[model samples]
Target: MKLTSALLLIFIAVHALIADGTVEGKLSVDLMKPSPSRPGYLPSPTKHPVLKPESAPAIVYLERDDGQYPRLKTNETAQIRQSGYQFHPSMVAIQTGAKVNFPNLDDEFHNVFSCSKAKHFDLGRFRKEEISSDVLFNKPGVVKIYCEIHQHMRCFVVVLDTPWFVKTDPEGKFSMKNIPAGDYWLRIFQPSERRIQERVTVMEGQTNTLNFTR
Candidate 1:
């Protein structure tokens, strides 16, 4: 009887795990330019002096704004450094209500502000090693972050309603686990890369993979 009960418990646990799904994929940017002659061989620009124009491509995911995924909350902390007169990690993604730490790591004081419709606030000038302020993204949208003294300094903060969202890594890879099985719309974005979207269905104990190129 004891052995039978143990087996039953194991089966129930397995079934519960199956109720959750997962997603994994890679995102990458491709610049369309003239190809060099042979492999690892290119005409010397100094010698040819041919003018080349480059373009930036990007992709953004499309999602519904209805308040869903209540249990998919994630608490995170982020930083915007005042080095090189600019913000490092030009693009960042955070969940709603997550705290963002603005630390001045430079010799000069810095001011951070965002006038985007989604979020609007400003942190007055702050010195090195000091945290200017912390912000909680109450809504989901894109926020353009900038410095008051530096016009060239700019960064992007993507506030998401679901903690399941993640930015692609250096290799453009992203994954989310333990998602309740359901149908969802998946999208990808690159600041200068082409945007792509598709329908995704999450099944029990399965992984979905998507590869996008610009």
Candidate 2:
């Protein structure tokens, strides 16, 4: 009887370890009018207007109520390319301590710099041939990047301490899976918009759906 009880306890522990949940949601926000593309040094013959969502490409993340989470291992480097006098994918989300590379694909020189509290640095002007070194984001907060040479070029990088973070699609749809079942605080961040937060409970082997509109 003692041996049987021990085996049953082990099985229960194993089951708990494998328990996970999923979170999925969508976001709706005011649409932003397309910005007219400025003429670049190497301008193309034809120009196409680019449309974007206001305060968009939001970031959604889950944080445990108890503030217990495993440290994220930094092994991969993210990239934000500079082309046609603009920052490609104007927004990005990354785990704290990760590195980001700003590759200039344009013929003119670009200077990348940020004055945000989370990080402050300036990568002097560099062209396509002389790419600047990668920037390491060690703090958790929003870092707003800009080009010193071009007033129209801008980008935002959100550094999060939690690993359970994902970016919303162009249509505002987002989903995250394989999160450990527990109580957590779900939060969302978007450029030029107010932050949103809410309490959420995750059940083992279950999925939770939530939505936000602004």
RMSD (CA, Å), each prediction: 10.1, 5.7
> In candidate 2, how many Å is residue 51 off?
10
Per residue, candidate 2 scores C-alpha lDDT tens digits across 78-170 of 998887777876778888888999998777788999999999989998988675899999999999888877755778898888899988888
lDDT string for model 1 (43-115, tens) is: 3222222223323233234354454766344566777565756576666777778778888766666789999
Candidate 1 displacement at residue 2 in angstroms? 18
* Candidate 2 C-alpha error for residue 87, in Å: 0.7
How does each model score on TM-score?
Answer: 0.73, 0.80
Alpha-carbon runs more than 4 Å astray in model 2 = 1-18, 30-56
Tell me the TM-score of model 1: 0.73
Least accurate stretch of 10 residues (summed lDDT) in model 1?
43-52
